[model samples]
Target: MVLFLKRMLLASLLFLLAGCGQTAAPALPTKEKAMKVQIEINASVPNKQPTKLTLQRQDLVHKLYTTISALPVVTDPNRPCTMELGPRYTLIFTEADEKTLIEAEAQRYGCRPVIIQGERQQRDTNPEFWKLLDQVLREAAPPATVQKLALLHNGQTALIDSAQQAQALYDALIKLPPVPEGDPHQPEKQSAYQITFFTAHGTLSGTIDKQYARLEGNEQARGGSYYVNDAFMQQVQDISKSAHYAPGRPDALTVTVSGPEISMRSFIDTQSEDAPIMQQLYTKITRLPQKAASCSTEEEKRQKKLTTTSLHFTQWGLPLLSVEIYEGEHCQQVLPGPGSEVQPDDEFWNLLHKLNR
Candidate 1:
């Protein structure tokens, strides 16, 4: 009986070990499922102070809904746009589409403009819309802040200490000089600060350097600001040369897709031996996937689609992954092979650290 009992215990232990061995880490999305994007704008505003703008869902669809609700009069769609300031000075767009009209109107009115998909039935002022509009009006109206600066490397983000810092940085961004018109090395103005955030999908480059801060609108402009170092700028240039780099005109960001089946998970890895606070960023980045999806849908003809989120840190000299998803037939564009899954590699992280420092 003693021998039998011992054998039973041994069997139980073996079964438990097998179960443990089979356990796997929680699943993360693949790169093929994600889409990478960036937004950039150049502006010249009257106020030097940073302006805060939010997208208004109501105002953007004014042409369609206003006619239905009998609020504002609808005009010919093919006429030229005539913009005027004041309560009565009407803003018009002759050739503007919904997106262009929204952006242009927002810039002219000094309010955050949101693009609404539907119509409004009533005329009552939306408390949130007025609040946002009022806040924008009362604050600075600096022009040309980056709507988005997507990294050639996709799906990356940079973590600030707090929302306040994020606001501060954003507010201060407009006063900074424009990103040099030419190569980063030969720009007419140099950046006061430039840092790149890396993620599994790609990277994000941020600049708040002195030349940018000295704009006419900025009352709080500083004389001696530290911008990105030469090595760092060169690194940015080098990354742009990769096969993935996509060029842009004055107002759009250049996106580069470095590798297939890219991972956006690095944006969330706060396990830095250097910055403990970065770990908390992992939790904050949960919205990354949703944010990426905000502006994109499955491209009708594209073979594959991916949603990616990424963040990089020059401060800690590390990059973290956040989220990645794979979709469609051509997702293999970033994938290794037919059935291979996405996995994190140390090689990219090492390169990020080297370039950032």
Candidate 2:
């Protein structure tokens, strides 16, 4: 009987160990999946200045939510001694969750917690918003209607006519979400590029940097400023460069240069089949500087007697390029004709001679 009892005890112990070692069942898929999350971080450190990071991947967002939710809440009546403005983070979630989850997470992380409330809470997931957005994009002009799409920025313009090129741009623009309400507290840098789509419908223009886009009419639309992430902006720029207009028979060419001493205008005929020199002139004039020198005072500028030159390159009646030159205070003007005293013999005059020939 003693041997049987010892054996029974040993068997029980083995069974318990086996049960302890067994793996837990996998968690069931969640019905409340996250559609998007915006994390705003405010840090005292200069390098960590307040910025917002947006995450859209459901799995990663879920993981983040789970990790944050597990942090223990701080219940200190007074501000926690550990808090000294190192960094404060605010998380905005789009899916359904207990309000306590955000509070607990904030307390655990020692950061301020905010839940996007009211209509803003459902901004991304609302079916109506999506429907309206879809309609706006659909009406944003078809690729066929686009005659030329141009990117105008930094006093330069690049034009293209490929339908595929226009479609890529339209695709990028359509992906932008409606701008949120209220002016963001963060300072906005000037737009890096202004894209103008010349379509049969009309001219559609937008000023966009990498992170933000302000469409012409969309600012007053129900949705405020179009928010575009960095990746999308990079893709747009890449497509723009790839679809740059290929030079062919230009319509016309104009070059204008003005300086303290002299102003000159040159027009070249690019429409003629035999006018190869017109293309060369077009290349030279467009390459000129776009802006005039910085003069501190009107009197000083007047004393400089700045000359202005304008050049027009044309094919038939249409002008291809119009060049305007404002001569710098230190620079001198050289005329192309005979008996003209050319002091500063630059490439400008060399190209002018080619055009004159």
Candidate 3:
């Protein structure tokens, strides 16, 4: 009976030892060297978005490598897997690994593992694409390349000859990253403005969206959209506001004023060499009051309709300035000109009279 008890105790002790020995396997070793790595998660499943994580730090890269390595690899070839809901992972390591450990480790984490071979394959395969893009960058580098820029917004055009603005725009374009192909099924938002880069070599046009820019076409005929950084877009807005009217040589200046029961038009010819007077006229025309007069009664409201005055300055048979003015009901009462009863002691009326004479 003593021997039987001892045997039973020994058997139980052995059983416990066996169970302790079958503990979980240890984690795999990680690569210690620094590496330029990019991990992309491409999900084909609905509502499962794709993500990309780039790592340059040695410690972080090692941690990521080890984490993937620890996962159990899918061994069964017949394992129930479908590409439709694929959570495929692509791991790109700049340094070549003879053992392909990273690829094997990535396989355990996703449906498939893709390894990038070298830098050459990462760029656009077409040689002409590179040449055209490089040419654009070169042509857009110098401020002198752009002679004139036409900015159109809300049916109003402002022609500018600012080198600072042109340089800012071109620099932003050159800094744009390579465009990635967007999902065809996804909808694209409308662009805010269109900028045409006129260089001596040729013309390049593009549209600027909130977060992206679309280059219309290239010499290779490869047109695409690229990501625009926030800093670049902000710079574009800052410089674009520099667009304003600058006085140019003109052949004639025509002024038209229309109000409730009043309409008057006048013209000025530049052949008279009225530079000083014209400058004063330009200043007065642009600085006209824009607010409408207040009226409370029905009769006053009927008489208080806003007045619109336009100054058309033409140069070499072309229109230079198409200035429009919309002022309150008191425009006729306050304006100093042929149609107004109140003639103030300002030179505005005198200049108008001289131009018309």
Query: For this target, which candidate reaches the highest TM-score against the unseen true structure?
Result: 2
Candidate 1, residues 1-357, lDDT tens digits: the string is: 999999999999878755432221222233222221111222354543332323223343332223212222122223333454322111222222232321122222322222212322112223444433332222223232223232312323233333333333444443333332232544334343344333332333444332232222221111222244454444444433432333211111111232235432223222434243343333333322221122222562253344332233223232223223233343311222223234333443343333223
- Cα lDDT for residue 335, model 1? 25
Model 3 per-residue lDDT tens digits across residues 126-145: 23332332333232233325
Best by lDDT: 3
Model 1 TM-score relative to the real fold: 0.21
**All predictions: root-mean-square deviation over Cα?**
27.3, 19.8, 20.7
Whichever of 2 and 3 has more lDDT, that candidate is 3
lDDT per residue (tens digit) for residues 91-155 in model 2: 56565453222311121123333122221111111233233323332233222344556665454
Q: Please give the distance, in angstroms, between residue 163's alpha carbon in candidate 2 and its true position after superposition.
A: 3.3
Q: Runs in model 2 with CA error above 4 Å?
A: 1-165, 171-196, 201-208, 214-225, 234-278, 285-300, 310-324, 327-347, 350-357
Q: How well does model 1 score by local distance difference test?
A: 0.31
lDDT of 3 at 128: 35
Q: State in Å the error of residue 114, model 3.
A: 28
Off by over 4 Å in 3: 1-145, 183-189, 220-224, 245-357
In model 1, the runs with Cα more than 4 Å from the true position are: 1-192, 195-206, 209-211, 214-267, 272-301, 305-357
* Ten contiguous residues minimizing lDDT sum, candidate 3: 118-127
- For candidate 3, the per-residue lDDT at 300 reads 38
